[model samples]
Target: MSTRPILALISGANRGIGLAIATGLARQGAHVLVGCRDLSKGETACKALRAEGLQVRPVELDTTSTASVTRLAERIQQSYGYLDSLVNNAGIGVDDDPTLTTADRLQRTMSVNVLGPILLTDAMVPLLEASGRGRIVNVSSELASFGLRADPDWAFADFAMPIYQASKAALNSLTLSYARQLRDKGIKVNSICPGYTATEATNYAGNRTPDQAAVVAIRYALLNGDGPTGTFANDHGELPW
Candidate 1:
């Protein structure tokens, strides 16, 4: 709270957009914690960042497991006493085929993409409240934009990966709900639509790089007290809910 460096955590930071976000936040003088399901992978990522003379540490985290989320909250509570920012970046859409998706596949996708963040955010709220400057950034996608998808002229209009899109839409809803609820506590909660980026998740087909897509998330992570909350935006500007 004083002259100490900002303490931030970014989930799924082992690679791709999450890794880019961690690196970006670190460069901005924040002591970042890279959260990854694979400890070895996270260690590798952090090692690379540390080599750049950045303040970064790796933490083992599996977003889908309540035990994992709880453990992380506890560890941060003990080690840092408080957290300045929480970035929920772990997501997956393995079941992209809306028509042929089974209940199991839908459940798996939702568990990681929606339920995981909800659980983690709820767990981190206490630590964030301790910070007095808590911020939560939900990594979302424009594909979740009901407004854009409804437009006939929108690109990718004909494509609908129900499992993935629905999960992000649900995440957007969580952003609004959490922002309003945490307003009195002064915690800024908002959603960031990191555009389609060239990542393993996209099979490297997107036009932007992970670093390009990570800028908006870094911006929201470092928002001021007057910054917008309970809203959705991207690198360019606000997007329709």
Candidate 2:
């Protein structure tokens, strides 16, 4: 086995912030696992990373699918037996009639954004515990900020994508709860607001690049054993709860 001290798994890593984080970690001598829904896209990403001489492996993981998540867990257990970091980066933003958002949309968004991560983390907790210094990075957003929701000047408040916003809020709450539960287990769990990253989900309206956002995620992923947990931060600073 290579003597690399880090092993990282990032979901939805075929492109955007997830891809950027995988590349960054791989460059830092970590064995990066690129978890994607599309096997072709995963292979393409893996080839690109390998071309750059980064240790990257592609793993199929559709976060919304329970079967996929279970298979992913099994594969990781058999392949590495431990996980140093897990970056929950998979999410979806369905554009339906804001006022008439159906229950299906709400369920879908919540499944992928909230329940999916919870299940994945639960499945991987054992592997993380095996690593003894594991870290969990939940890729949250500023829109999830309850404080921002209360403020009229928060810019995104008027945006009526309640399903997406609420899903992320639930994700942030899950992060805190999981962090508290894992605090004594030598694992650190934290949430990050990527600050309007220019990804497909945002229609590129975001000012910050995916690579820039990846930096913050990577920092949280590589934190020391005593680092802060159950917190939300961005490139600017820590966001108010």
Candidate 3:
């Protein structure tokens, strides 16, 4: 086993679930890179965590921009040379406006939630490969489960946010693809739903807190090479695809 301390990069870690994930990893002795679009907020989050004596660094990364994403990878490469984990937690939701065109909604939602992560992962895969024990955690949602949504008898079946749901569903697919492609490289990739966590994304109207949801993502991030890959799970356990 590599004696090197775990190094992780978490996107959109200024607040909410991303911040929670960063804190959890830092608390467990990992060097966490907190990625945020706004440098000030990222530094603030890093400062708060550092006050707790955790190893945390603020990284300004706008996942939606290739330039920003590339810069972050280069920074990480120069600073650490390798990364043990990546938590792609940055995402956004759009109003389910009937007046909005599908193209508009998809472009906005998929850009941040889907394309951004894919691009970042492509750029960072090399650094992750450098780590003997690499992991990737994509913070997904139960709402992304098509099986549950398609089930008429399921509770919360009435809950429907097309654009948001579609984005997560696609993320889940991407998770599987990366997991399979990188399995030989010893990189484990998995998707996790933080549950109905109360965050800005949900307007703080969720049952679970950000800390609660952070547990599941952190668990997968710290997994060993023998751990499950290409899977979707949460606090409760494995979720249906």
TM-score list, all predictions: 0.97, 0.94, 0.96
- Candidate 1, residues 1-241, lDDT tens digits: the string is 4899999999999999999999999999999999999999999888878999999999999988899999999999899899999999999887755565488778988999999999899999998899999999999988999999999999979886888889899999999999999999889999998998999998999899999999999999999988999989998899998
lDDT tens readout by residue for model 3, 81-177: 9989999999988856567788888898999999988988998999999997789999988888987888988887998787898899999999999
Q: Is candidate 1 or candidate 2 better by lDDT?
A: 1
lDDT of 2 by residue, 1-241 (tens): 4465699999999999999999999998899989999989999989978998899999999987889999998999998899999999999888464654488788788889998899889988999999988999999988878898899977887877778889999999999999999988888999998888898888887898989989999999999866899999988778987
Model 2 misses residue 40 by how many Å? Answer: 0.9
Task: Give all candidates' CA lDDT scores.
Answer: 0.92, 0.90, 0.91
Candidate 2 Cα errors over 4 Å, as ranges? 1-3, 97-101
- For model 3, which pairs clash? none
Error of 3 at 28 (Å): 0.7
Clashes of each: 0, 0, 0
Candidate rank order under lDDT: 1, 3, 2
The clash number for model 1 is: 0
- Please tell me which model should have the higher TM-score, number 2 or number 3: 3
TM value for model 1: 0.97
Q: Report residue 52 deviation for candidate 3 (angstroms).
A: 0.6
